[model samples]
Target: MVILTQACPIQRPFGSHLYKRRRDFQLLDKRSWSLKPLIPRVSEDQDTDYQLRAVAKLLADEMTANGQVIGIGTGVAVNEYLREISERLGDGRLSGVRCIPSSDVSASEAAFLGVPLTTIEDVNGNVDLMVDVADELDLENLAYIVGRGDNGPQANQPSLPRVRQLLEKARVRVVVVDIAKTGRRLGGSVPVLIEANEDIWEDIAEELDDIFIGDAEIRRRSVNPDAGPRGGNSPVITTDGNMVLDVQFLEGLKLFGKDEIYDRIVAEIETVDGVLEHGLVVGVARKAVVGTVVVSAIGEDGQEEVKEESGPRVVHL
Candidate 1:
């Protein structure tokens, strides 16, 4: 029964009346475009690499083209999609795709895949599409949370990521997740990652601990940098060189009986002093490509067996 308190009204849920009109991937003007429901849902246990590749391929076909600037994010899913992009580029189906990477990890992967790489600076203009992964998805809410390794924080006076800048930089933000991760349900321990000032992370963590009580907890990511060559003795630093915070919310935690607690919490954290960018991505993802591998039918023994398929259809959300 945690509440947002008067301290943070921006996190407050807008009236249900307003949510009604805006629900269902309507961040962009609903009149602008329409998505085809070509792919259908399969199994709840649809967390497979093959399925992930299937999702990547769909995006590769739909989003990529020659002489386009693409923004790539870091993650296993992005890597797979990059492989698809490379295949297309290598075969000359797609050429001159100048990729803008969000992080160093993405840059390295794109380099290895032999995809032409560029930076936000060298984009020359707006990016054609930015593909990233989501740790969890709330279909009903039409929002997703990033930062679970499935996507991570610190503080003093809170700092906000120049989110406006990112929004202006990338033309379109599309989130891709496997079938299992897409639903009204929230998954994993870390819902959002916040980057904070190093000197005041202790206090920042304490503040979160107070506001988000119960199963909600804050963790600081650490790495040992002094052990040896591949050391692991220092706190993990972001590209911006800030401390990291992992915020976990209890399972099935909801507010206003219908709204997602994770969404609510992201709002509260933003109002806190010394806070920076959080992983709750809102308004960025206009369309989502969710791929599924459905194994149905029982064997002679009455047990369902795994089946292999290629180029599985994707459910566009």
Candidate 2:
């Protein structure tokens, strides 16, 4: 009975002209590719907060029903969704809706929001739904990249393996992001968290560089720890004491068509000597709720005028 329904009509999304839903999609077909140049766009805009709130509200409605046990992910978009769910629970509109947060930050935030919390083990891995956010998303496929952009180690990142396991355990998985985050191809580096013999990490990085089109740099912690790391030589360590290697693609891997390099990497990257996990999430999200931006029109004064309205679209994956 858990289904995604739009509470309101969504404004035409930014990339409607570029992306269309098709049942059968090919990864390497140039004819099937609508791949645009991956330009750097800001996910945070003037209307972003509004759009996020709207997306949060849309998901909260159905997620609250049937006493569902939800799996929450990290980042600001997921935080907003948590806020919406929390408010509904507080007002007595929702009950028996427990949550399993992906990271410590989400867990603390959920506690602060007065939403009851549970674990995957506590629920015996029977999560009704998993809701998360993405850094960049391929609208053509449900594939996405999570985690902050190659910024050493994310303070809020839980065990990457655990996060992946939770996503796999869920009955349904949904990713919510700003429309700006969607594109023809996903950009950014793929983080490889490794736990191996100290001497072999350099060899692994060298091997990764040979396989991919970019450098695979081992991440370092912030030297100052207050104003962000300007330059540091110390390797950034994970909570689990694993080392992180961020494989930054200089030009992007879309030249060979969608998911070519990415799929190959995802399948074989772990086979590398030291890799524990990587951040290239492929086709995991079954649905997405994307927040639209404010539409604009030319005014009488020959100036662009921003409209007050924007909405969220429930995209089938």
Which structure among the candidates has the greatest TM-score? Answer: 2
Please list the C-alpha lDDT of all candidates, in the order they appear: 0.52, 0.58
Q: In order, what is each prediction's RMSD in angstroms?
A: 11.6, 14.7
lDDT of 1 by residue, 1-317 (tens): 33333222222111221111111111222222111111224564554575667657766765567887777655666788889989998888888887776666767788999988876666555666666555566654445655544233221111113222333465555555545566766644542344545566666666665555444555665554233311124665655666666665655443333444444545566656677667665442233333353222122233432322443432234
Q: Write the per-residue lDDT of candidate 2 for residues 1-317, one digit (tens) a residue.
A: 11212122222211122222112222332211111111122344645576567557756753347588888878776788889888888888888899998877889999999889998899888887777666677776556776643423367765677668766777555665555667666666667777744666766665454444222332323323442211145555666777767665554543222345455546546657677887777752233334352222222233433222345344454
What is the lDDT for 68 in model 1? 78
Which 10-residue window in model 2 sums to the lowest lDDT?
Answer: 30-39
Residue range with the least summed lDDT across 10 consecutive positions in model 1 = 17-26
Give candidate 2 regions above 4 Å deviation.
1-46, 149-153, 213-232, 254-261, 284-317
Residue-pair clashes per candidate, as listed?
22, 0
TM-score (C-alpha, index-matched) for candidate 1 = 0.65
Which stretches of candidate 1 lie above 4 Å from their native place?
Answer: 1-49, 150-168, 191-198, 224-234, 253-263, 284-317
